[model samples]
Target: MMTDTDITSPVMDGMGPHGTKVGLLRVLGPAHVWALGVGIVLVGEYMGWNFAVGKGGAYAALIACWFAGILYTCVAMIDSEVTSTVAAAGGQYTQAKHIVGPLMAFNVGLYLVFAYTMLEAANAITAGYLFSVVATMTGHTGDLDQRPFIILVIMFLAWLNYRGVLATLTFNLVITAIAFVAILVLFLSTSGILGGGLMEHAALFEGHELPYGWIGVLAAMHFGLWYYLGIEGTTQAAEEVRSPARALPFGTLAGIMTLLIAATLTWYICSGVLPWEYLGDGVNGSVAPLFDTARLSGSNGLVWLLGFGTLFATLASANGCINDASRAWFAMGRDKYLPGWFGAVHPKYRTPYRSIVFLVPIALIFALGAPLDQVITFSILSGLLEYTFMPLNIIMFRKKWPLNSIKRGYEHPFHPLPALTLLTLCGITFFAVFLGYGTQLVAMIGFYIVVSLWFHFWRYRFVNRGTQFTMPWPKPQGY
Candidate 1:
């Protein structure tokens, strides 16, 4: 096996066989990373998350979401510290390789790949569904199938990702801005601040607060998780960042704070304007909660705007997912964890063209085959497993490399407390998933086991023959 020094050597700066240099352009700044972080997750503000109301009613869902927000905040803080310190691609996967081991790193990488691609598929599906909704609302539709639209969306994003990171992220900023404005409009309208007169119906429970009681709140945890699920994608851009030590932390923290504000306003306004039961009903569950809310408020203009806005948000999210997932795949390939072809960057665009090309078909398959709820469940489960290791990674980082030795742009307060808290919350979230969807949990475990075994038996030998897995820490003197 290659030693840490071998892996961290300057000579192996992603030089593939035949002396090909596989790398990305460092054209992104803090603002771009921030836009990516928000863009990747803005869809949740428009849809998906409100499905929690279906499980626990409005009040119970709100409580669950609030708790989930806290957990995500702790996670974001810890992740920022790691991102600033390590400043590498692949986010949690890179962090885990240095702090844990290669095996854990492979697992995390695979999990992230699954989570992000599935999220992209989910967003594509949502986009198609929203388009159908818009068509019907506009009184022009006959036998509309969303599957073709989903495929088109996947193809479009794949093409965008292959073009270049600068162009992709520039577009991301514009769409993300539009998405934010869309949410702001919804908040103002539903809050009666826009003279919508919808706040008069703002009742908390109205006899439908907790249909499944506290147990329902547990069930809602996964749905609530949707609100902040993709915020961590910011760290995946470390390799492409202009100054990762400063940009990663600032971008990630800014993204988290913005999502928190948006989540709160979205939940409060949507629940207030519409009956909790109506919002929680199965038919409208995850399909178009926001659109339905605007429709109920007697605003055709608002509904039209939100429908288009939801499409923009979902497309932006799908685009961001491709960007993040391609980087993780690229990182793994560059390190020889998988085939080297996956690590290849476009000569002209400086993006992971191969990985982006690879994921397009997979996303299309997922969009066509799986139900939206199942897609969400699997995505959340995979994400939670990846998240469970982050706190432990933090503790290990501090132990292996003292903080004083590293140049950190940001650090979490209270030392290990945030890590511990995040760990506990992760456990709770995992248990909630198990309690609610036992079969899905079993399937997720089986998937992880299979992937782990494949790595150990087949891929490990190949990767070990050529490359050494190492952390991105500065070498000590005389090493």
Candidate 2:
């Protein structure tokens, strides 16, 4: 255990010798923090969230959006508090290792790596398809295989991560801002502000707005996850932020606000213009709902704008996913949860260069190997598992540390209430996922179970106990 002499701050002072040899560069600010979280989640507004429209109806999708908005509010609150305190690369994984236990930490870290990696794959595939969709929309489509597009996108984004975090996330910030403005512009255009309104709500929702009913809304909650899946990823930047206390809470809170607004506006604009059947009619709903809505407006300018938004949003999402996934993998490796070799940071770039390179092919394989909707489902399921652990992590955090044991950057109010709300929402969303993708859900759980067994039997034996609890905090109440 660390003494007061061991650590004067929350940064991992007890990282042992491995971290001393190399370390992540601390050069990020609140803007980068916002970029990392918003860049990863804004793609949902462009394409993925419409899958919920397919499961329920337009109305059901809207309800699910509000429901998920609440759930993720809790996510933001809890994560902001914990991340402010931990200030580590592993985010919740690091939090779990310190407050929960080794096994739970292992699973949480896997959840981070797999969830973001799968999201990265989905983003690559979507970016590829965005080009093809626009080609056909413009009357110039013969047969765009999208394979090369997917491969190139993945390789380019991985290269960005390989270079440096600042360059990678700076690119994300620019593109993410553009994509967000496109949504805002679309909403304003349709709100009777640009000479005349374009949306015909009466025409779009004529007796078919809620065809599937309440149960459908319940089922729709699964895809509702798309609206805010990676917003919690803001926490992953805790380790690198110039000031974790200020940056984590402020950036994450700002990010969630941005998403909530974008989600509401996207839904209102799309529901007003597009038919429910058209928006939700596919394996995973409309691939480019914003672009399609732009097409319906009969404005070539808006079409080009939203189309670019779709493409840029996907690239940004993939870029942020690589950033977050590599950090999680690198953190696990630093403590021998996976392999010690991956823990090494690049001496020149000071990034987790090894882990970043290793995840590239894994991203490509999942991108090429699965259908877009299936890949998204995989990402969401893995994301859900980590969220189910959130309330527990926070509860244990409060009990173990109580208040005032250490200097916290931020503290969430109505603590147990947020915890209970998060747990209940996660339960409801899990049921929603089960209703739609029961087989995949079961298979995912089974996969985790198998990995858990492996970790217990084999991987746990190699974990360096001294390196795991590297957080510089006083001993817990019970311990």
Which candidate leads the pack in TM-score?
2
Which stretches of model 1 miss by more than 4 angstroms?
1-22, 200-204, 282-286, 465-479
- lDDT by residue (tens digit), candidate 1, 104-214: 999999888888999999999888887787678679769688888888889988998999998899899998988888888887877768774576443556666578889
lDDT (CA) per prediction = 0.80, 0.88
The number of clashing residue pairs in each candidate reads: 0, 0
lDDT of 1: 0.80
lDDT of 2 by residue, 1-479 (tens): 32332122434532444555556777889999999999999999998898888889998999999999999999999998888878788888888998999999999999999999999999998888877877787798498899999999999999889999889989999999999999999888877887579878778788886788889999999999899999999988776778888999999999999999999999999988888877886544456889888888888888899999999999999999999999999988888999889888888988889999999999999999988778999999999999999999999999998876776778899989999998999999999998978999999999999999999999999987866777767779987
Q: Provide the lowest-lDDT 10-residue window in model 1.
A: 1-10
lDDT score for candidate 2 against the true structure: 0.88
